[model samples]
Target: MFKSLLISALFVLSSQVIAATATNIAESAEQVSPLLPGLAVPNIELKDQYGKTVSLAERFKEKTTVLIVYRGGWCPYCSKQLANVQKIEKELADLGAQIIAVSPDSPEKLAESKITSPNYQLLSDDSLLLAQKLGLAFYLDDKTAKIYRNKLGVNFVSLEGEVKVALPVPAVFVIDTNGLVNFQYANPNYKVRLTEDLLLAAVKSVSEQ
Candidate 1:
């Protein structure tokens, strides 16, 4: 009876912590405080492009991970960045690193995005749960959200059908097999991104450590 009570108490505490984190999401992209180097990457489970659950921690355990957080498939800048990464996917793999891209698109949308490459994995974070936990989630302003939905035809629905108006500031994190972030780069400007050359250099540096 005591052990069961302890388990229930721990569960409730964790739920409260997550709720607190969710409530603290930044109001704008510029205000987001992305996770920094030396911090342990959050071990959250997110749906892959095929709707299969993939754990961030499990992926980290396999090898060094290059985690790319993008706004969505609807963003041209995001697409370009993904393509640039593809060009150096082999180089990264040769250095014993793997790449994983996460975005606020559902599994179906992820499939439609056609951003997949054989060398890397794409995961869906429609609810922005992982982003929030990493301090990288921000609420899109009403005007921008409306423009995206009405003009751009970008669907904001989550996997459970609820609308999500949050996006992750475009960021890249190099995390080691132990899940410790080795380097990070995040910028609120949607048009600007870390270059493929810099990303490859970052991965190479992490692999040596």
Candidate 2:
């Protein structure tokens, strides 16, 4: 009888551990799931290029927002994307939309980006908090992190001094004045990006709606 009771207790403890592990995995997966259309944008505060605190939700309240999330200033692809977006900045303004780009680079680095445009806003997400809330954050494996640090000299240290190798999937989200995402595009492949035509179309659709 004593042996049976001990076995039963151990089984219950093991089951609880398994359940906890599953729950953790689920949460992690959810964090990486891209935010979809019709979802309310997360109202996270981030620092603008000048290091001023800015609320994303407040920006949405001002006008339709064309939000872009990129890897960092060090990434050439991100530079190209920013340049492409700059080409359409005038048209976006004509449609009454505001462009806001977020990246893991520090505020100082944002100013140094090759594709900096006066027409749009650049915000820093060095802590990756905003990306995580938007379901666009992903951790770099140890091997990749080592390559990025040693070979590329890309440090993942935040402004607050935390070191973590994480990056946001490049994404574009069009949020209306109501703070609702009318369209979103996210791709895990760093090389691929949404075309300017598609982005303009998405912004136009949101403006029309």
Candidate 3:
């Protein structure tokens, strides 16, 4: 366990070095990335935990949608954020909003995240197609990648592999039915995620339109 914790810390430090110029993202469970805000939200088609095809515009037809993208279930912070948002889902819906969470975790791993986050829709960005298209993907260097695998046992290979490519740093954006982003929450630090209260405010504000 100590080794794992150390590995996780080292992993975070590595991510920080890479995201230094843009945003300072970190590790998870309850960790939130500090990647700064971006300009737009692109159309993306990922999968649900059930391996069913999902498209943003289609699911959110004629309604407001919130896109909350994360690294994967590896972090504890993501779980907390997901659970919190789900708890206040009613508050969000009251403002005429729908929400979807995205991650690069394959359906199998995403299914594990879904087991913990059963309420919200978990979209799988297995190929990270949208992240790459949106310029949100970042490749992990060797030293850092080694820590995630040799130390933390992150298990990305079962889904993809360590030598794969970049993963999407955690990010959140609220998009209106028109498919334009109204608000965004991004950070490179994995420890910091947007609070549910703040997200609720964004929903309320946008719904007034």
Best by lDDT: 1
The reply for model 1, stretches above 4 Å from the true place, is 1-22, 115-118, 152-164
**Residue 86 in model 2: lDDT:** 90
The full ranking of all candidates by lDDT, starting with the best, is 1, 2, 3
- Looking at candidate 2, what is the lDDT of residue 132? 72
Per-residue accuracy of model 1 over 92-208 as CA lDDT, tens digit each: 999999999998888988888665665599898877788887888877788887877786554353323335566788899999999999999999998999998899899999988
Better of 2 and 3 by lDDT: 2
Report the number of backbone clashes for model 3.
30
| TM, every model | 0.83, 0.79, 0.71
How well is each residue in 122-208 modelled by candidate 2, as lDDT tens digits? Answer: 999887777877888776767787888886555463322335466788899999999998999887778999999999999999878
Reference-based lDDT, each prediction:
0.84, 0.80, 0.68
Better of 1 and 3 by lDDT: 1
> Candidate 3 on 1-209: residue-level lDDT in tens?
99999999999987775554342222322243232333445567788877988877676665777788877777688878877788888777778787788877778787775344333578887666666554556656557777766754442421122243356667778877777777887776668889988998887888887
Q: Which stretches of candidate 2 lie over 4 Å from their true place?
A: 1-31, 114-118, 151-164
How many residue pairs collide in each prediction? 0, 0, 30
Cα misplacement distance, residue 39 of candidate 1 (Å): 0.2
Best by TM-score: 1
